[model samples]
Target: MRTTTIPVAAAAAILALTLAGCSGGGDDTTGGAGARTPAPPTSAPVTSAAPTPSASSTGGRASAHTEAELTGVFQRIQFRPAEFTTTDAMLDSVYPGLTVSDASCLAPFGVGWDTSDDAGTVVFGTSNDRSMTAVVASTGETAAATDLVEDARSALTRCADGSALFSMQGKPIETTVETAEPSLTGTDEAIGWRVRGTVGGNAFTLVGHTARVGGDVVALVGWDPTSNTTNVPLATQMFVDAL
Candidate 1:
């Protein structure tokens, strides 16, 4: 795990594609074996759309070039300067998650505590009201990206259906994890999941994906109470393209 100072200019990006505001209409729970999404803000304006991420042939894997080199990528998703935070300890302040009910889920998707270390760099932010997070850390045991990918895959299996992940915020957000197809492409490996549960007593749906692009393991997440999961694949693609 290594750390790099984020350039001041990189924080001013304004092309937030995926999570500007929560999507509209209904939830789309029509996939399998993907990943998980972030919890929504307790209070947000319903003016922006939620988003996802994708990858490409070259210069896309943040690990191949530098450690935790995802500042620019998050910036592309409209994570304004004030919206960004590099301190891993303050994750709960930005992302809609805390400790999860199923401890196994923490290693991979939910909190990703085992994914990276404090020595590594963590860049998290909220786009408009949509929260997105990226961790550029090693597997800790050997700094191997494949190991982390396997961790996520194993988590999907161990924390099977009915597994509850509590993002204890605003009256406890209890999310149930279900497998989904990989919405992101051109990666060494990818995993996806669709989480449906309650936030503030209202039905909420989250579409999320985790992919190993080259030497980097990137996770994309977004949730809406309305269940509008349209173009989720494209949402992640937008992030992958940014890389």
Candidate 2:
């Protein structure tokens, strides 16, 4: 097999979506139910339709923190200024099939920073072997947002022993999943998980967290080739408090 280096940011992106139940492959034994037969490896990318407009879109007000304010919040949490912010359009182009079924999980729904809307994302660290990403967004659905966090908790539990089999950059890879306690406190809801596996002979570990704050949702993803543990809750709390 040809050697390939999956950048930390790229792995973070893939892991975040996978934890959201976006990536396809492997038996779905989630919910403590009977295992669903594993689907055949697919060459097609996973795709989802845009979220249905909620009443807030028409009647209630949907608010998001200004980019500058969000930037300030990230800075307080130890993230450097965003080297490059991504918009919804950019995300669509880069991740065509990536989608979050629950719009309440606004952080994963829009992926990276959404320049067109009130949401934005930032990447920190300069090392190619490690990277961290923070995403924050508001959907004006406090209850739904809270519920989304709970749903994520369930998904994480179900997928704890599952494996993700998919292609990255046209190369096939498999990652084992494990559940981790979400350390976030004083929040509406939160959960986390860890993924470990090898890519082109290079072993990697990814830690991811998703949390809901009032009417907003935030997700933090950290990737390291050498270490398996990451301080995801700290970064999550910083974004949640800022919201």
Candidate 3:
């Protein structure tokens, strides 16, 4: 992993730095083929935009899903399903699946999961950085977190020839949708968007959702939070599976 680290404190209006799905709401870990046991909120805080809007939903899905719900789903996976986690070795092993290349990876902040239930955003992030915000969506879209992954795929379709979507401060990141083979799932004609963003004041590469994973879309995103971009993309991609 590179040693580039972006300070979250310098980011503008960071909504919530807490890991996704570990809210104080009680353990919401759900098991397979059985009723889910609601555990106490795992010390993680839910990041919400200020001036909270009167909950209005766009899609039929309930307003934003709680982090606990997202986490429960991750915990239910056959292996360590977390997109990002406190366990470094576990993160290193699982995150590679989400990557466009081994050279890129998810940055670290606090290893936890997150959900934008109100905005229909479900994310499991490694760190908190302004440039790290990956998805933007309507609350209705979030209800179908899987669909949001499809939406991301659709958006990528717009950028042919390996174009990527980027988020920049005081500017809009340009993107051109493109098609690529998912190196992990061995799916041809898989949908993808190549993403680029500024890190440590320089252009950096980020990629996500190159293939469909068990009816879900996954993306890997990264920045210069650490000089190494090894696992950031894998972490973001893990969020898609966790959703």
User: What are the per-residue Cα lDDT tens digits for candidate 1 across 1-243?
Assistant: 011222222321222223444311112122221223434433232222222233232442433423234555544445422232332332454333455566656444435532344223444444444344344332222235566666777876776444255555436665577775564435556667676776667776666666555545555555543322543344444444444
For each candidate, give its TM-score against the true structure: 0.57, 0.52, 0.34
After superposition of all CA atoms, the RMSD between model 3 and the true structure is 16.5
Query: Which one is best on TM-score?
Result: 1
**Model 1, residue 231: C-alpha shift (Å):** 5.6
Error of 1 at 182 (Å): 2.1
Q: Which regions in candidate 1 have their CA more than 4 angstroms from the true location? A: 1-63, 67-69, 80-91, 94-98, 101-103, 107-110, 113-121, 134-143, 163-175, 199-201, 225-228
Tens-place lDDT digits, model 3, residues 81-160: 24333333323322322222211112211112133233233434233221232322223332343454444554444432
Worst 10 residues of 2 by lDDT: 121-130
lDDT for predicted candidate 1 compared with the true structure: 0.45
- 50-83 in candidate 2: lDDT tens per residue? 2222223123343544557655554444443344
lDDT of 2 at 34: 23
lDDT of each: 0.45, 0.45, 0.32
What candidate 2 gets wrong by more than 4 Å, as runs, is 1-64, 80-82, 85-130, 147-165, 225-228
